[model samples]
Target chain A: GEEVAQTPKHLVRGEGQKAKLYCAPIKGHSYVFWYQQVLKNEFKFLISFQNENVFDETGMPKERFSAKCLPNSPCSLEIQATKLEDSAVYFCASSQSTSGGHNEQFFGPGTRLTVL
Target chain B: AQSVSQHNHHVILSEAASLELGCNYSYGGTVNLFWYVQYPGQHLQLLLKYFSGDPLVKGIKGFEAEFIKSKFSFNLRKPSVQWSDTAEYFCAVRAISSGSARQLTFGSGTQLTVLP
Candidate 1:
């Protein structure tokens, strides 16, 4: 089975509207990660969490993007105000390493968001 | 900063031809490496991974890669290519023992277009 899962395979919103995406990490996995792929570029890291505690958010673009990992529910990434530049595919990944060891990260189907 | 690099940005080849995608990383210490493929309209899937043991690792769909510690490289390869093999290939890495080592450092990704 796929290790990570994401919801809302596709989404479209106005420039000023809000958009939210979800991710469910693999069972028993303690680390979750989010990435964004814009247009024809690479997948850029957004944030990462280790057991509900943020481990690193250095790649995250502040000012409108935020994410959270809660117990029993899928982690989420919310954008307050959509921008045309935000139209891209968002990928979520998970790993089982709590100590940041050599665990392989598993990726999800990803959600393609189109901001109009 | 730790990073992954893919030499070939776009590769086009005919069916039955040999395939090789170069990937390199810049990080000191033990690490886990992986090659992922994202087919058109499909999610990213792990093709193969290398942790320890032999440097040459094989992946699904007839893909394989070699881990060169000295050069910090993990390149994907295939003996005979197929049109179905056309997709985006990504190289990712994470240190085996380090803070946030579970987080992946991905490359810009290479677009492989196998012609039939």
Candidate 2:
């Protein structure tokens, strides 16, 4: 069984401030994914990475949101100038590999972000 | 664009009652389906998944799902649910393709509240 870990289970920030979240995927897992769950309770894909390379970021906000998955460091998702709209629970997920057709993902306990 | 639809937003049931959660996807190509459960204040956990196999798939905690290809649906079912089964259920899908990036599209979750 894979276990994904996330840091700072709760975060509170003021509008216009910066917010950063960290995720450590299961050991040996190469695929990392980020998602945002708003008050509406829907999980929205934000970004995904394969190893140290970004695979898909279609759901990411281009101007203020950025994510990275370095080799030795934990994957990070940062939001510059946080807004009320950015207040949501951010979740991290991981999978072993994407080469095969089927890869089941394991999710981490989400980081709850509250922007005042 | 791929999307998942969960028809039921809230379901209340007594112990020993049958449970069914509807999940439908909007993609025509090959895809992988998943059902996840989120207990109160906990992270999302995989309940079951359907990749490629028999149309009927069984998962942990006496949960099962059926993949109806022609209907483009994967519906979760439990013959008898318990109070501990009260949680939020999410349905997700990922397009299966070699060249495309893999990201899960989750549905608007269904909240199950089981009474003892």
Scanning candidate 2 chain B in windows of ten residues, the lowest lDDT window is B95-104
- Where does model 1 exceed 4 Å of error? A1-3, A98-100, B97-101
Top model by DockQ, which number?
2
DockQ, candidate 1, comes to 0.58
Write the residue-wise lDDT of candidate 2 on A1-116 in tens digits.
35899989999999999999999999998889999999848899999999999998899998999999998999999999999999999999998875666788889999999999
Write one digit per residue (lDDT tens) for candidate 2, span B33-112.
Answer: 99999999899999999988899999999999999999999999999999999999999999986433488999999999
Q: Find the number of clashing residue pairs for candidate 1.
A: 0
Instruction: State each model's CA lDDT, in order.
Output: 0.88, 0.93
